[model samples]
Target: MTDLCVEVERAPRAALVRLEGDLDKVSAPAFRKCLAGLAEEGCVEVVVDTAGLAFCDSSGLWVLVEHQRTLSGMGGTLQLTGVHGVLRRVLEVTGLRPLFASQL
Candidate 1:
């Protein structure tokens, strides 16, 4: 379980959530907290920067999908950026790549 650190920054109508370190079961809780901030702010759009992500697991993917669903239900959106390698393959395999705007 690699350490996960999230840094959040807000823009006019969007929030940038930078995800650093591994994303797995151990880190999912912290990931959730990051999303909670976005929800609290009622951000119209969320940009999840995964450039620093070192790893991921099913639990991590589940959280992402949940956040996407929640944002859509709230009339907002979640966008992904800097995804690559194994994580990118996982998203592609899950067929969730098309559901959100992706910056690969």
Candidate 2:
């Protein structure tokens, strides 16, 4: 139950969010709120860096998918970087890897 830590860096129309620790049902709400704040600020492109992420549950995945859909609908994009371990496997197993604009 590692606490989630989020760090965001904003650009003109894009943002880079670095996520650390576990992303589960408990932390999804905070993550969702962070993304919603970016959207409200008119951010179009979002890059999520998960190098420090230790775990992710279904609730976390759902939040990501939801935000990806939202950004896509607005002609924006959501990309992921530093994917590995369980998160990588989950995305692959769920066939949801292609949903993001980029991955690494």
* Reference-based lDDT, each prediction: 0.87, 0.94
Which digits, one per residue and each the tens of the lDDT, describe model 2 over residues 47-73?
A: 999999999999999999999999999
- Models 1 onward score TM values of 0.92, 0.98
TM value for model 2? 0.98
Please report, as a residue range, the 10-residue window in candidate 1 with the lowest summed lDDT. Answer: 36-45
lDDT of 1: 0.87
Instruction: Please give the clash total of every predicted structure, in order.
Output: 0, 0
Number of the predicted model whose TM-score against the real structure is largest: 2
Candidate 2 Cα lDDT to native = 0.94
lDDT of 2 at 30: 98
Residue 33, model 1: Cα distance from true site in angstroms: 2.1
